[model samples]
Target: MILPIVAYGHPILRTIAKDIAPDYPELNQLIADMWETMYYSNGVGLAAPQINRDIRIFVVDSKQIFENMEPGEKNEYPGDEGIREVFINAHIKTLNGDDWPYNEGCLSIPKIREDVYRPEEVTLEYVDENFESKVATFTGITARVILHEYDHIEGKLFIDHIKPLKRKLLKSKLDDISKGKVKVDYRMMFAK
Candidate 1:
């Protein structure tokens, strides 16, 4: 099932998500549904909160980002090719390297894209879908997607990272999204 994504300004999006236990009911089904929802929305990443679930779970298949890149741009995002993973109960152990600005968008905030500065690499400790713990490092585009989705679980959005002036300019657009005035193909739940 592809759940309706909750739009910006929805209270659930602002609430910090909780870590789920191994016995969380229907965990496998929920992950599968999330993947379906993400692909249907043409999104590289989706957090549990985005799907109206306040839990520490996110799915990413950043390979789509690499596949659509121009031949000359392929090398620009090294180490991100064919990266796919499920992050649960994730903790960012380290955020290292210089800050780079990446054009970011969210399924919740339709029709809005902004350049958000983020670390180039991230070290994370997280559990897989099966609740098996693992520690890993990611860089380039893969890191960018991970960091973006991680923010959802932390009650933060990509727009929150932009300059105050830019964010101020987007206030009306953000309000439109909250009131369900934005156009989006996939289903979305709005605050209004």
Candidate 2:
């Protein structure tokens, strides 16, 4: 099932998501539906808040980004391989390495890509779909995607990292998105 993504300005997007227990109802089904919704919406990552669920759950598939790069285009981050995984109740253990800027976008804020600066590597503690806790480190593009989704659970958005002037300029556009005035290919539920 492809769930409707919550649009920008939605209160759920700003509210911090709660951690889920292993016995959360239909856990497997929700994860499956998330994956389906993500692919259907052509997104590299999706967070629970994006689907109107206030839970610390997200899925990322950075491999698709690497694979879809144009031919002859050099990889920006050398030796950076992609990863595909799910993160549940994720906590940022550490953010190391230099900060780099990348054009980031969200399924909830469609057609609004912005350059966001993020650390090159991130150490995270999270559980998988099975609820087994694990700690792992991610780097390069993969890490950026994870951090982006991680922000969702933290009640933060990539736009928050931009300059105030930029945000001010985009005020009307952002308002349009919340009012369901923006057109997107995927289904989205606006707060207004």
Top-scoring candidate (TM-score) = 1
Residue pairs whose backbone atoms clash in candidate 1? none
After superposing candidate 1 on the true structure, give the runs of residues whose Cα lies further than 4 Å from its correct spot: none
- TM-score for all predictions? 0.98, 0.96
Q: Write the per-residue lDDT of candidate 2 for residues 79-139, one digit (tens) a residue.
A: 5667789999999999999999999888888788899999999999999998888999999
Query: For all the candidates, what are their Cα RMSDs to the real structure?
Result: 0.9, 1.1
Residue-wise lDDT of candidate 1 within 51-134, one digit each (tens)?
A: 889999999998888888888898887666758899999999999999999889999998999999999999999999878899
Query: Model 1, 185: alpha-carbon shift in Å?
Result: 0.5
In Å, residue 182's CA in model 1 sits off its true spot by: 1.3
Model 1, position 153, has a per-residue lDDT of 98
Q: How high is the CA lDDT of each candidate model?
A: 0.93, 0.92
Please list all clashing residue pairs in model 2, or write none if there are none. Answer: none
Residue 45 error, candidate 2, Å: 0.2
